[model samples]
Target: MTTFTSFTFLLLPFVVFHVANAAIFDIRNNCPYTVWAGAVPGGGRQLNPGQSWSLNVPAGTKGARIWPRTKCNFDGSGRGRCETGDCNGRLQCQNYGMPPNTLAEYALNQFNNLDFFDISLVDGFNVPMEFSPTSGGCTRGIVCRADINGQCPNQLRAPGGCNNPCTVFKTDQYCCNSGSCGPTSFSKFFKDRCRDAYSYPKDDATSTFTCPGGTNYKVVFCP
Candidate 1:
């Protein structure tokens, strides 16, 4: 019993570290207008220009996406609407936003004890954005600052954003049928400009990136 107790004591620190291993995402808005930042499995906030909001995400959090909404009008009740990236007309979003919004996606503690992250245009594009792994073995942060809206393909242009082909067409060809399709001219259009983003269904080779778990990240708008 004495030996077992000593072994248990030795394992306590490892357990504590594993349980306490959390990733902090510091989201900043550098755009000229206010940004209603949204995250899943994480809450939402409004960040004015030069303002920053930080959220601590626990280790096991998965499939979390962060995006910014523009030109929002929220009353004292945190209920209102946004011009772009609005999430169910609520300020503190209880759900994901309607797309045509650039997405910064991450899943922590995935296979091989790594954290997978990417800037996904798969949802579409609203603002010039960036997602960087600020700490740990993540060096492939995506910076998608290209003016996709300014020069968006005429067919893919929306009011305040550029729509991805998948959103515009919604066909098996554009949506990829969950693994059995490929890119088209529209995906190539986004790929040619934003090389670090997901252009098509099978763009994981370059778009997806991984980091050692316990890494910290930052998502910036218009940066």
Candidate 2:
């Protein structure tokens, strides 16, 4: 199969000192968004929709893919997922339809990047608002594909309760049940869930999310 490419150049200045191509998914006039899939040194910044940039993908990079950042919303408010057609509804945004063009192709076809290849999509074909990569453990973990396939079962706490880390989550059953990592009660649930299992601090806030099943499920702690 053809290689996938992406970039993360926004309104600000960005430079990738690697060997790869740049693709542009410019949605400025239409949706005010951009997606790049490559070895971007700096993660991302205030990216303008219409502006163009190059994705410097490393030659030997194992697996990589890129998508828009606005597709999924991780905020506790539940409004971040963008379900109702441009944040016009209450439900979480969903991704559907055919696959989007590779970042390299998108960039090269639209912009002036020549080091990339171009993959074709059906005419008037628009990808769903929320889609992600679950099969291939690509970069950023998820893409703009909407659907439960991408969202992990317990990685994110259900919308009903507050962003509590102790909630019974499948993504991090041990950490979720055992308040040892979170504020959950250190009772049987804790022992029953994560007793004798090794644990570690993923970050400074004591927030640690793990992957219990396939590499796809990202056990994230939403504080």
Candidate 3:
């Protein structure tokens, strides 16, 4: 009653506006899923190389889909099932040497909402897969191999390279003294100032890698 401050009253409107804006933003960004477009779920009867599909995902989400299944290299004499073959039949070795599994798993869990989409049932391999609506292309019969540079290294194969919603960007070859390709060591150096590891290619661009002791390298693909 003794004092009514003009300053206090003037600031009230601004504060209220800020709070209202924040509330509106929260409402818009609340949901973890988004509507997707493409073949109906479980309707992917056949997927051919160079084919394209689309899926719409929530805006807040990271890149769409996760590929849990690994590409396998079968032994000529083995039975042919990847999981049943000798050495676990995994395309690469188990553990750190193997391709990034958790990365893909996390992606799948977040996008698919923990739903399982079998690639085999969709006319493909038995690995995990998901779709993203961000992409576009023609859907048709009599599939043909696509001529995208830096994507299909094996040009000889027709109607047999690349799958919709999934593409093999590049095959990395780690040049080590052992003559095998892979990350052979892990290190954090320079008083822990820098930590480094390897990464696979994406978007036709090689990964930028830095290692301990100031060792840095970029993966380059050769025809």
Which candidate number maximizes lDDT?
A: 1
Q: Which digits, one per residue and each the tens of the lDDT, describe model 2 over residues 44-100?
A: 222344443333433323222232233433345444332111222212323321121
Ranking by TM-score: 1, 2, 3
Candidate 2 Cα misplacement greater than 4 A, ranges: 1-30, 33-42, 63-67, 70-168, 172-223
- Compared to the true structure, candidate 3 yields what TM-score? 0.20
lDDT of 3 by residue, 93-189 (tens): 2321122221121011122122111111111112222211111121111111113212422421113222212122232332222333432111111
Error of 1 at 52 (Å): 0.3
| Model 2 vs. true fold: TM | 0.23
User: Candidate 3: misplaced stretches above 4 Å?
Assistant: 1-46, 62-64, 68-223
- lDDT of model number 3: 0.19
> Candidate 1 on 102-140: residue-level lDDT in tens?
888888766655678888888789999999999866677
lDDT of each: 0.82, 0.24, 0.19
Deviation from native of the Cα of residue 89 in model 3, angstroms: 17
lDDT of 1: 0.82
